[model samples]
Target: MSKPRSLDKSTKEDVSFIDRQPDQLTNQSVGQAEPEVPTGSDCAIAQQSSTQNINALPVDVLPPRLQEIINEANICLGFPKDYLAGAMLTAMAAVIGNTHTAEIMPGWKEYAILFTALVGSPGTNKSHPLSFAMQPLIDFDAEQAAIFNEAMKRYEAAMELPPKDRAAKGYDTNPIEPKRVRFTMQDVTPEAVHRILSENRRGLVLVSDELAGWFKNFNRYNNGSESEFWMSVFNHKAAMSDRKSSQSGVFIRNPFLCVIGTIQPKVLTELAAGNRNANGFMERILYVFPSVQSKVRWNRERKSPSFDIAAAWREILSRLIGIVPAVDSCGEIIPEDVPFSPEALDRLFSWQNEVTDRCNAEGSDTLTSIASKLEIYAVRFSLLLALADRACGDEKKLIDADIVERAIRLTEYFRVTAAKVQGIVSEDALTELQLAVLSELPGTFTTAEGVAIAAKCGMSERSFKRFIKDRKGVLFVHSAHGNYTKL
Candidate 1:
């Protein structure tokens, strides 16, 4: 309205778990800054800044080696460093798999599992970084495929023998087929996923180049069971999948599946389709949506780093994969619990209280759902970070307060990104005229002011009233009598 009045300059409150104050960090030295310990006043300042200000990933909070790899990739290889960091974090979680989990208490455990997406437009270099981060798993899958192929050849020969001759030759007449040991899956069905988790027992990562297909094909085979299966896997819950062709179904206890992929910003709304936004499916995902997306210019003078970064990453993952998980007498893999230290437990509890308070204070379901999920993510990030540090040779016996503080910062980053994504999805759903009118409204507005603004944007008074009425809890939240707050 009135040419959108050059857009409103009034600030809206940002719903975030922690305030960003780089100067207040515990270790502010030049090399690498440690996590900032928030004070009471710092928590009050959480809503001070716009979430758009936090586009860069808090790389310093990561393990030193990981920070190095991300930096080298950014400077030398022209990859988006934050994209690499996000994908790398998920890949690391996949590598750890069901081997270990972070336990805040005896009954509260968090697995190193995540569902992450790198959000940008095409040609933003989203896919390459994902491939680099997951290359180690890809190689492992290739090795497993080779082993499976050789075993299949032998099994086919064994099947050719007569029942008695095959038994005499130390091969069962009905030889068991070789199940492929896999670390990554691209085209997978729910039953296939359950079967793989059953055979591997360590879990796997689902690598998708474009998440649009992943969401659009949720009901490709069945009515809508795939979406529920995915949600169950996200929580590492026990699940069973029955195929009509088989008399017995595949049953997996404690199924673990990590997902990492890239999605265009425009395609984000599709992710919220079919009640996903309201049903907590979207809340379970951590999105890495940078404020700016530009292709890195080609630097002719750039040179690859002398050391092999991929090799370093591969070695770290190899060490994690080598950690043999304990199993029960029934042959189920048992995850070792890495409990938090007393100080860490206290710190995490305090932060959880802060999140709960924020959730209680918010009127928007989207924001509250995201805040609740971030509480869970904070614990998972702590486990992933603590274990990554251990993998980087900074061994720790337990999750410490510093690690928890680091996880808080990581969670805050994701919180801001999630808010940014919500904004994108909501904005995409608005019409051009509606968006123009919305831009003209300030952080707070009255019905008369909104009517005046919409009038200038060529919207009828009746339409403006109906638009505001329909968008309650989405574009606008009722603040008071005749007053609304733009979300």
Candidate 2:
């Protein structure tokens, strides 16, 4: 095992784990495009594509229980394993919330939080896997809602009584409404999210089925204030906001938010809107975009897994939720520090040095920004993986070398996928003629076929070859000897 390759360079090594290809789109199901149910051939394509590309998620880096869940979900629900794995990672971070942090040194600490997006075409089964991963948090919020509703009824009944009567009825003359405890929020406003975060210090996860709206709503309220709020929360920094509706401003000492959502490949341009690309917002996101082949026909005969995936996932998250966070005298959460062992720290330092060197050597700002974020993510991932192992009964006290090694592998997987997303975003920079030529080409074609298609667009063979060669990872990915695929 050699160390993971530099982010600036592509690796030719044969990695074992299989994931979808990056940026390639399969045909949409005719009319009313419904959910895609992947068949055995989907797995075959995944296995074959892993040999040719490094964009796939390294599923083996995950914990054993999570591995089982991904396998069972794919077999039973036909959800893409890549999507499930990515969603599960975000789910775990949300569950961890602000309870724990990975302390790299005296001053540097990272929380287990992430902003992830699952990018795919329609009917690729992105939503289902995400729903499956986040069901536990949803269930927890539902329970809280029920509790709040009952308390509100009591409060309302008590409020109907006169001041003296209320006291006689064992109710306070003045009543404070019970604050709702929510672990997950969807389709919410920025101020609403801030108010909720102020009430519930555990933090919140924003789960959106379509992230296009998330981008579109960036400057909706106060001209980039919402975007700045999100960027601050991404770093777990202190957040304070004062609005006209509130007498007192809302303040959070350590604001934590983990966002997970899905968007189509064509929506990548929205990411660049509002200067998100020019800023660090685009780099903070981790994208799961699997290259896929044709959709598999629905198989009614596919059997469900013997073990219950939902129950297993619930149990795992429940264990994590049960871990109580330490609080200071001021009633603020004090994140429990999980430091790396000597060996693990050494391994982490080595990986960070390599990433730093790669960032220094790379010219592409997109890739460099991604590498820098992944450096922080590397520590966050190690903490999450270690705690997840504990939730699974590993009982490890400190982050070990093996866990750090796994985190490095996991970080590399995201590094590749983020590059793929950058490639998709770069397509927005394509000229009209290039976009026209790409729209005309097949999903996969030979060089001769590409030349013929280019000629149809009135492009010469020399120019066509130059276009293909220059846009190797962006507009197209070289498939084989003289073969290319539109990305």
Candidate 3:
């Protein structure tokens, strides 16, 4: 394995920065994180201590099995909600999302498409939760690969036959083109995604353990189409890619793409300053940054849970998979539109009107977009909940008032968390600039090394020190000597 980089000679220790996960949203789900278990009394005490900021949605926000998955992951890997909740959201998106399973209201059809970002520093055990949650999907893809390869062999054999023999064998040009069987695409190009979308009428997902790179290269093609495509797909609008170079291209009348991943807080600080996400990218996401664990509890004698969390995950997903995605006579996926129950419709429209009036009163773009979409997300969340509850044997899929109530609560939780993300990322340009400098430095950097890198940004040594000094317990945790680490 390669050694971690250092800043200078004689500084033997490492200096770390950007502890939070970066802007990776699309993908399959599974993750683990450390948990700060607080009793009701402890919570009360904490609240009495100050106006406590609960940075995460409570564990109960997730479904029972999903909650169990997150809990077991925490016990095993110490992943926090910052990681696991996003993974659970991803798990929901992947299982129920691609299928035209159910919908929300009239003329407003939507799948369970959700984008989640786990915001935390590295070493907090962020990636594992997502890995654990997405393991089932990953396994399913691997299983499908064998099927795809067999089809490819048949397709190639058919292509190579003589014209008469091929006609007799019912072979056509480009026959049996390998179906778009894969689901997860990580840090890939737009054309590659277009190809996947073309073949997989069900849709595709984008997932990354580390999201910083994805956001950095998001606009790499320099074409505005990527941005436009992302915006359009958020609403399940029909889209197609017209690639040159003798490609037949791909089209999907109903495109459902879900994004989820982790991002470093420092990278996000720099990234939030850019205008890339202003065009509905960030607006569509349910951003979350659960506060770090207040204490690390280690029981040397504690035995690891023997239960198979992945198996349990697969069992739930297997049921969802049994509910086949709708397909057309042309073998394309036909989405099943779900209407709101009388009670659900009443509650949803009440929420819509309330939010519309509130946003109009507030006159905030962010709030307006958030309020509008959160209600829509509520619908999606309700459908997912109703479907899961039914498929798992509780009852048949029914969008009811109870589901709507829970959906609203979940959306409320995400709204608070997203505000926390936007507040930090959008504010403090100097801090963002400083974060950029730290990101460039080796994890452990000497004062001279830091000065040299900061100077490239037109920052003088004194100015840099002044900047770091002011950011004491806020953005940084000062280390010994001239070294520092991101908090």
Which residue segments of model 1 deviate by more than 4 Å? 1-51, 167-176, 245-247, 431-436, 442-487
Please give, for residues 1-487, the per-residue lDDT of candidate 3 as tens digits.
Answer: 1111212321111101111111112111223243333333112211211211433454554456666666666666565645676676667676666565455544556688877777766555567778877777787888888988898888889878875688678777447567748667787778887777666666567887777766666566645567668768888888887767327767777777887788877777655534653655676777666655333354465446668877777887778766676677987776665556888778766766766775565345655665666777777777776666655455544677656665665666566555556546544554667767756765445677778989997778998877655543233334455665443
TM-score of every model? 0.84, 0.80, 0.73
Q: Give me the overall lDDT of model 1.
A: 0.75
Model 2: CA > 4 A from native: 1-54, 162-164, 432-487
Error of 2 at 8 (Å): 24
Q: Candidate 1, clashing residue pairs?
A: none
Q: Name the TM-score of candidate 2.
A: 0.80
lDDT against the true structure, each candidate: 0.75, 0.76, 0.61
**Whose TM-score is greatest here?**
1
Candidate 2: tens digits of C-alpha lDDT, residues 1-487: 1222222111212111212222221222222233333333223322332423424566766778877878777766677777888898898898788999899999989998899999888778789889998999999999999999999998998989987899888888999988998889899887788888888888788999999878788888789888898889999999998988767899999888999999988888887788898788988988887655245457687788889989999998999988889888987888888879998898788767756664454234555677778888989999998888888877778898878877876776777677677777777877888777888988788999989998999888998888777665445655556776665
RMSD of 3: 12.7
Model 2 steric clash pairs: 21-291
- Which residue window of length 10 is worst by lDDT in model 1? 1-10
Consecutive 10-residue window with the lowest summed lDDT within model 3: 11-20
Model 1 per-residue lDDT tens digits across residues 418-438: 767776777888899999999
